[model samples]
Target chain A: MVHALGEIHRVLASGGVLIDLRPLCDRWSIEVFSARETRHTGHITDLPPGLEDDTAANRAMHQAEINGWFIREKEAFFPLHYVWDTASDMEKWIDEEWVDFVGLDEETRRATRSTWALGDADSRVRVKVKMLLTRYRAIK
Target chain B: MSARKDPEGNETKHLHQFADFAGKRVLEIGCGEGRLTWRYASASALTVGLDPDKNALRVARIDRPSDLADKVHFINSHAETIPFHKETFDIALLAWSL
Candidate 1:
């Protein structure tokens, strides 16, 4: 990650800005059933069952570690909600995009399907993703 | 289960607050399918979208709007080894790349 930052620093011109947007380490949590239900039940804090590396934590640590190379000018948190047309779509995304994570078991999938079912019998799942937006200036 | 709607234009809204691309040369690394390119390409003087994924670049090229044909250019490249010369672009945007 530091190497990538160095490459970015190298490519940036003087006074150039680097917009580093990534998932915040400790801020990531999944609310599987429903917004209200998840809110009342509390978010799942544990890392997904099969993830080998702590990506969010590593990203946070990387940001701290690379602070010296670039000067942070602004920072904010953004909420990104990834909504799927159906529970199957959500499962496909998890299977393909999030191959590293393994906690999406049958029980969770079933709950998501049921929770996202519409009155008209439509099924749509929404996943909440938290992103950290940081703007940095390359230190000459 | 209840139906849910996808979030609308949140990224663009956030991006507008952070930087202005007017008349600036922009280089977007890891630009998958040019999702954000079309949003700012018109405002930017010149926009170059680069990604290592050939398939994604192909999709981006096919989807390129006629108005932005001259303004935006898609290239296949990696972030670690950018092909352009030093100081080529005024603003380098990674957007969700990193």
Candidate 2:
């Protein structure tokens, strides 16, 4: 994509502003995708935990990698947080809306649901990200 | 060992190996609970501490030293994009921030 953009910019007018914006959302975005049942019960936090915490390091590395791609005119960070409080909120919406779904046993679902209620899922399910937005200008 | 003393009798190791910190803008990128933020605030008059987690920021602000807290500003933000003027910070400490 970077190569394609560079090639396109080569033919553009002398002063062209190339604004590239992409959400740096990670796997935790799934919290918003949980079923209504999971949502109401706060079971959405049942998502598997990451092996390593990659928040700080990943952000830095991503910025460095993108900087390598093009000449950055300006760079900024925007922080955001998304939260879903209950299992039913997630389970109802997801289960009813989807045509195909995977079924879990009542016991397992109950266990997961309880875990979310304890607030353990707050950090486990929610993802706070700093969106690194950079505006780059082609250097001829 | 440096021989720098605060209002108290405690001696601080002034890292003169670096430039002056008094009245200079500073940024504590990580600032986990203001452990080092308080340390730096003791010397520098103007310092800002940033962290993404609100809970951590609360702890840093509350438990931080009163003397240092007066000089430090705590903000809930990430390191990737610092919310300040460019080249505003003379000394940005990243104690375990990376």
Candidate 3:
């Protein structure tokens, strides 16, 4: 990953910007929401292989800065929502795509569905993804 | 089991806070299916979206907007060994791939 950062440094013009955006290796909040309100359902932890991947990515970015390839400029945290049309839809998707690390066991599934039931017809269940959006300046 | 991501447009909005895309050359690394690439490509003078996944690249090509046909291009490559000359882009965005 550090190698990739170095390559990015190489391709960018002098003082060009490098933007790194990715999900944080932490728990995601499951919620039921509409335009008016949001209710927290449960938290789903980002698990093993994926957690390790993101952690390594964080370390690599720090290493790249340490190497003086790029100067850290600014960063922000934002909530990225992955919305599902229905509670079951989210469960099914998680079973296939995120089962490796996302902990959506029977209890979490129940909690999410319970919250989904309390919302209006327009309500949807979503995973609130925590994201780190950082920009750096290439030190050419 | 399809899910809509970033319906609030926060990703693009937050990205805009970091840099201005208007008329600049941009490179998006690991631009899977060109999801984020399409969000900001129209503002760029030139945008290149590259990924090692050929299947994803194929999808990105298929999904690319018609107007961006001249403005954006997809490359089948990896970030570790980017196939480009030095100082090729004004901004390199590692969108959810770093």
Candidate 4:
């Protein structure tokens, strides 16, 4: 979160306006994703089926938390947008689905640039989705 | 369940500690999920909740209390790049986010 805020500060003009949102005790329930429509889903392969990572949302809120350096704006209430048209469109959940995090036995870890690579690269899949939209702002 | 995390479950008691929010602009840093945003908004302050985790913010926005919707602002931005200038807010509340 701190790394994200530094980027925002880099671009924001001095004395800019910022509105932020933070969660105290919150958890997210990701809707599951699969290549097939509930075909008795199972961990057939080490790789997850699709792409899911909401880095953009994290960047936004992280910037908001550092409002101490900026001029605070009128506090407004905005909710996150959680509805995506389809399952494949939900990108936030893709990382957990696609990445095979199993510990490398030995030779496999040295064979590739990523320690999390799948045992069978042929079965790997990558997909994107918009799981949610959060509200945040920092204006110069 | 949301109200349970309040500094004190009782609104009146928490309000006493948060009296700085009265008619002031408030920025809540590290609001895990805006559980307090709902209460602070109802207490007569314009409050904003700032969190970096989108997964958590997703639920915060989904279940925000409807009654205080107009009084608060939920932003997906970070604590540093807040859209405002320095010294702009009357009060900044960070509940155990150190």
All DockQ scores: 0.45, 0.02, 0.90, 0.04
lDDT of 4 at A123: 21
lDDT, each prediction: 0.67, 0.46, 0.90, 0.43
Best by DockQ: 3
Candidate 2 per-residue lDDT, tens place, B1-98, comes to 11111222121232222234566666666676775566557677677877888888898888867666567889887665556653455555444334
Task: Report the Cα lDDT for candidate 3.
Answer: 0.90
Tens digits of lDDT, candidate 2, A32-113: 2233333322222222222122343345434534655335566554544333355454344435532132223465457545
iRMSD in angstroms, per model = 3.9, 19.1, 0.7, 12.2
The alpha-carbon deviation from the true structure for residue A31 of candidate 1, after best TM-score superposition, in angstroms, is 6.5
lDDT of 1 by residue, B16-93 (tens): 788788998888877889877887889998999989999999999999989889989998988778777766776778
User: Ten-residue segment with the worst summed lDDT in candidate 2 chain B?
Assistant: B1-10
How well is each residue in A1-140 modelled by candidate 4, as lDDT tens digits?
A: 55444444444444433333332112222222233321111221221211111244444444555554343334332222232333323232333432342112233223221311322333222211112212233444
- Write down the RMSD of all candidates, one decimal each: 4.4, 16.2, 1.5, 14.8
Off by over 4 Å in 4: A1-140, B1-15
Superposition-based RMSD of candidate 4 using all C-alpha atoms, in angstroms? 14.8
> lDDT (0-100) at residue B49 of candidate 4?
72
> What's the candidate order when arranged by decreasing TM-score?
3, 1, 4, 2
